[model samples]
Target chain A: MPDLLSPALIMIVAAMAIGPAKGHLRTAVLLLAPLITLWAIWQVPDGVQGTVKFLSYNVEPVEGSALRRLFATVFALMVFVGGLYAFRLARWYELAAAYAYAAGAIGVCFAGDLIVLFLYWELMALFSTVVVWCGGTPAARAAGIRYAIMHLLGGVVLKVGIEGVLISTGSIEIRPLLATDFSTWMILCGILINAAAPPVSAWLADAYPEASPTGSVFLSAFTTKTAVLVLILLFPGEPVLIGVGLFMVVYGIVYALLENDIRRILAYSIVNQVGFMVCAVGIGTELALNGAAAHAFAHIIYKALLFMSAGVVIYRTGKTRCTELGGLYRTMPVTTICCIIGALAISSFPLTSGFTTKSLISLAAANEQMVWVYMTLTAASAGVFLHAGIKFPWFVFFQRDSGMRPKDAPWNMAAAMIIFAALCILLGVAPQWLYPFLPYPIEYEAYTAGKVVFYLQLLLFSGLAFFILLPLMKRTETISLDVDWLWRRAAPWLLQQGSRGLQPLLVFSASTWQSLEALSKRMAVNYLGQPETADSEERGLFARSWPIGATALWIAILLSAYVFIYYTD
Target chain B: MSDSDSQDFLSRPQTIRRLWWGFSIVLALTVAAQLVIYVKGYFVVDGWFGFGAVYGFLSCLLMVLAAKALGYFLKKPADFYQQDEDDA
Candidate 1:
């Protein structure tokens, strides 16, 4: 019988085991834990399976639904494959933190209440910062601090919303919430922060590239995608998300077009890809929701594949900027071919997973008669092909030879890439294999002759445009300023100036207090013969020695006035 | 998969000429495909002949130009953020 255990808990336990289990034993646990969790996920049936009471509220730790299963299944698979890619290359603690991070993602997947989900949300934030710090460079350490602060602030915002909801509604059930009230809007804000929605979107690009190569591959799989999942659950059909998602799509492309680092380009594209899922959630039809879910699944596969390929390049050559690397294809053909496949998949080229899945989103826009939206989405599709699909491979693999002939990917890394590459094509050819795993039943057809032709023309012509505009798209060693600059530079600068400006006021106040005490003491010594007052300052009019006759007359006048007024009232 | 053939194919001027011709032919085939496959146009302008090709090409040009314009304002020295950290 399948034990009723939270799969996330199993992975968390595996993380604990890794700290002391040395050498091969540690590898076995790292590899087996995710495999075991995969089995546990499959064994879960569609309903609430495990519940516990905490603080007079029932918290369901295992809620079996199609959406939860799909997300958990992919997350589990990512941990296993990401581990395979990392085991030979990464430090043991990095693997441990990564597994714990994956566990937190899985925990959120099965969480049936807002409180439980928030806990898992925090778990991910804590451990992912460690993964970023594992990069061990000064840059990584700084980036990780920024990353943690952003997520923690997001966590606090989410907690406040949860508290408000609990007080008002007297329930913690995770259910659909429209942004009709302050609490719901707060919840939406909190979730969008994690989704890398605008204003805060820079965190994704800012920190992700600073992580170790294996750390980045794992980072690519979770966080924003999980936010996409939660959005699908909580705020489907919220019309405002349509605008937000579109902004992200265009922003990602424009920034990616400007990016120089290989991984940072991939990072910007993550926001772009997640933008499609977010837009679909706003469409909120069964077809659109399925499109969102399926696209998330397909994206995790191909994006990780792309990042894995990039990781190998970084591992062997110790370089990441596009201006410094190229012509590696001659020696690293396997890595190059795998990268092209990943590129094609991300661009939704014909007979790849992206084509099979991303079309459903465009089709959803068309079905809704959103003419402007449909046009922009179609245009962005071509832009994706330009910035990520072509730019990544062309600049990193096929551009002007930097004369660096690094070795091909090691066995483990190559194995991981090959598996994902195969899945990209396999799912494209037979999408039915993935469709059944979606949150809704699949009724839409993906492949029509017209769509195939339309996409081919769009993506191919974009490629042609890329070659034509080759001179304009020159690589430069530069970084684009993002919203994080306000906090990173402007906020710090303002704080420093404020402190420096306040210093004189503080010193003046302290000296004035000392002088007052000295005068008061002198007055006390002279008049009252108290030693404690020997340094006291002279008092004002109220503290002067007054004649008894005058004081009594004044008190009598004030008392008479009060008594007269009181009697009249 | 010999080194000479691979090198000559990518490096030679003749190969470049052939590639351009091949690319033009493929573009022509896609334009021709519009005549045979009836696209269910989602909007009024979408039904125009070779509309997808024109729109795709023009949109790409616009995106690249827009991106380049934005890059002028947004791009900074790669060490812009790092300078403060090193100072600290």
Candidate 2:
């Protein structure tokens, strides 16, 4: 009853209804659920608290605070809308798994203990793979297999770190660690891998677009954002992440700039968006952490909004690549406008959601006098506008006007996008709506002439560069190289070569064993002559010693007699 | 356990042309609201600025289009991995 009183309970219950309930009931479950969830989440008072325990571990499954509660609230809302968008076309398993996955993400938001967080963390991993596998394409199946392996490896590393912390510190509270120890860094890496930091970045673009449209929408929301949330809670002030985050920031833009598929470009941009949050967490100031959290908050809305547009395109035309798709603004005008809103928000254009929030983190870098990090982040901001903010909407909606326009998004799909689009603008227009919920008080201003003009000029110029350099940047039918190449291409190749290299060793061992066997048999025969055995001087000098001794004695006796006679004369 | 009883609901492909049109109408309303805001003193700009901001918008737009053109060419076939890889 305590949990049921919460909106998270209602939203999840409604999501479960997507799979089975017949006809109109499913429709009701789809559309009205998110609203109800939003209402219930609104009612959860500040400082509302509850807990449940098992196995001598007290699990703070629900600690109701404005911050934790808001994240959970958004997560629930994401699920309901995602459910509405999905349940119609998505398979039962995909629908069911997505709901369970959302619950896990919301579960983590509410978890006050590391143990509970770990449990939910693994849950997110398990169900997301199911969603990816639900793509049902051959590509989906292969990508899903690889996706599962990568996440499971990440989970093992995380679990090892958790166990190490539990053994050494004798606690499992979900509090910030300075990342001083091996265990902590391992835990951070474990989480960062999910955040799609370097080296493991290939798994995301490799997997997500292969997923069914509905699944991609769900996949985009949870995993990396949860990593950001964990970083906010666990390693808030670690400076190493600044360098790491910067690398991911620009990496996403360049790779995305090179990407051809609409969803995959957005996929790379997710890492880039997460890099902002990662940097904020690295800055570790209250405002910076809030920026990270608020950015995560707005990010979920805008990122999901972009995915919805792409999903709509994929659904109508069954084409996902930017090359195959262009000039849809002619047919799908509504989708175009909504996607533009999302794009503007992600680019941090003045008066959009991204404008209000992402700057706080970047500003924090500036205030800290971290000039290199600041410049890197600023260029990355421009890069965001270049790759995702403009590129996504332009290719899918406007561009050369590909002359084939199906219908706009379905009611559920449009509704989801509209709701998110509203949030993106609402928060931007009035920062107070999202500000208080941040981990830190945001005393910063989002709308200054200097700042706005600077961002615009940077983004505007980048746009010019993209156009000016257009000839060099042609979309060849190729995927840009990624860190995942190590596993997907390089490791598999090395494995083949390694086996090739071992062939000689195998042959040498086989021949050597055979020769040794023959030698052992010859020795076991006792004598080479066998039954007619004769041992002779051929056995060597040790056997012939007595003949030489007898001859020497006779010679010595005669030599002594001759010597004595000579001496007497 | 049988959904055949609800066959009418289950079988129909659901023509949402009306719904789609309705949502578009709503979008028009929002765009109108923005137009209204522009009309009133609360407006940030004079209007959507059809050709007035042409260079700014076009420079941004064409830049995106060209990048997109390149992206299309750069895009590997969906089966790019398979082209280089054989399971054996």
Candidate 3:
């Protein structure tokens, strides 16, 4: 019990202590503390390690189970990678808040009961908003406020759902709750919103890109992936997620196909990848679950690598759009190479990390005999190559020569990319290492020859399509609209329209009140005269003379009237 | 790495040749690695099914070409959207 409490407290304190430092010291502390917390997390052997009871309600801070450990492991790794990208350039305050956010994520993953999960979940919401605000721009500040509001609303829904579930079910263990109750569905929706699932996914592309470059790198790792983890645990085999996941996948590709901004393209694709995970959770097979976990790990490294490369470009040239930048490969070869490696990995080119992991989820779909969904996933895979895989590097590095020749990324940045790229290839070649740690046992082979050949042909054909269709894929002045535009643009326009109509009614009411006051004042002054003031020296006639005489006369009259009435009756 | 020398590689294409050679070598090496895996399949009497090696190499080649082709469109003039003074 003390052991679990100790690590959470330790990580929280480490985060709080980060505010006082500056320069390299700040970076070191932020990066190092998570490593220690990670080690502490795995120190206990697996299965129910800590508990406390408050008579009716019992709580466990640490549930040393395989599922919990798997999530905690990834959360810890994210901390390190997030630190690597962020600490080098982020303000100490930002780094501090980021570490605190990470600690909260780890806390949630390790939590055994609903109450603890809710607490850590809200903490994650709180601290991540602080990190977003650290972008220190008007756009970031506004986006952060919106981001915070959305998360707080989600948190409230989740808390109410948790209470309801606890009351009805009489158990708070964080395991498969099924899709039976409104409370469970509400919880699922709340979590899905963080996962960047439909309708509200605009929050991610809108809010994330506005953050500081380092902040984006950190922001990319945690929120959606953690939701994937929760879904895997709680909603496995729920068939509805299959359709919902499919929607997210197609929506992501179509939106990204039309997007102009580079990071937002990546952001939408994050939804697409999590959609794959969500589908895997829905499939609920052994291979599907394993694939979801493996894909998540690979996605983290490659996505972070992608964001870091983008950050390096933005840091040097202060540009982010494909339209604004090009020909950088002339000087920044390392970054170009790094970005390409990340792209290939994302495209699931056969020998990269993505193929090794992502194939399992697709294979799981095939095994389930879901042909249409399977076909859509295959098409989405091709579209991934089209937008993110091809478009990102092509536009960023090698196009008709932007003639801006920034030097290669700073050494630390290059080191981070190289490490991730190596891991991408390593994992692809020797997937056995990743295979063991997945949430479920994986009986499927990722590198079957027939399957590999088919995938290559299909994806290569898609590459051909990308080049053939390049004319339609040009950068333009106008922003490509999405469901988010409905909120960020149309909703705001509607709100302004509403307020405009409201303005006249409010003004008319105020004017009417003023006119009524004027009429009353005019009537009093001209005809009735004002009442005596409160501080006048003499009493009024009504107050002083009437009460005693009136009381005696009224009493005698009432008695005579009563006697006459009684005789008449 | 100091900001003083950050502009050292700002105008050169020396890495361009290196990138070309390096990418070719990578293409070759990746294909060779997969070819070894493919050769073991030759003994199993499924010659028609033994296109994994070719498919693998072809995928790498396709990837690099896609790299070149995409390089055609989205890559723009570095100062394409910047203010005029920043361009100078």
Highest lDDT model number: 1
lDDT (tens digit, per residue) of candidate 1 on A1-569: 13446789999999989889998998899889999999888887887776788788887777779999899999999998998899998998999999999999998998888988999999999999999999899889989999999999999989998888999999888888888888988888899999999889999998999999999999999999889999998998888888888999999998999999999999999999999889989888888889999999999999999999999999999999999998888889999999999999999998999999998988888899998778988899999999999999999998766778899999999999999999999989999899988998877677888878888788889888999998899989999998988998999999999989999998999999999998987776666654444444663444556799998999999999999999999
TM-score per model (chain B):
0.85, 0.39, 0.34
Whichever of 1 and 2 has more TM-score, that candidate is 1
Residue B83, model 3: lDDT of: 33
Better of 2 and 3 by TM-score: 3
Best candidate, DockQ? 1
Which lDDT tens digits does candidate 3 get at residues A74-94?
A: 667767767776666888888
Model 2: DockQ vs. true structure: 0.09
Stretches off by above 4 angstroms in model 3 are A6-8, A53-56, A499-569, B1-88
What are the models' TM-scores?
0.90, 0.77, 0.80
Which stretches of candidate 2 lie above 4 Å from their native place?
A1-17, A31-51, A504-569, B1-78, B84-87
Candidate 1's C-alpha runs over 4 A off are A1-4, A510-569, B1-8
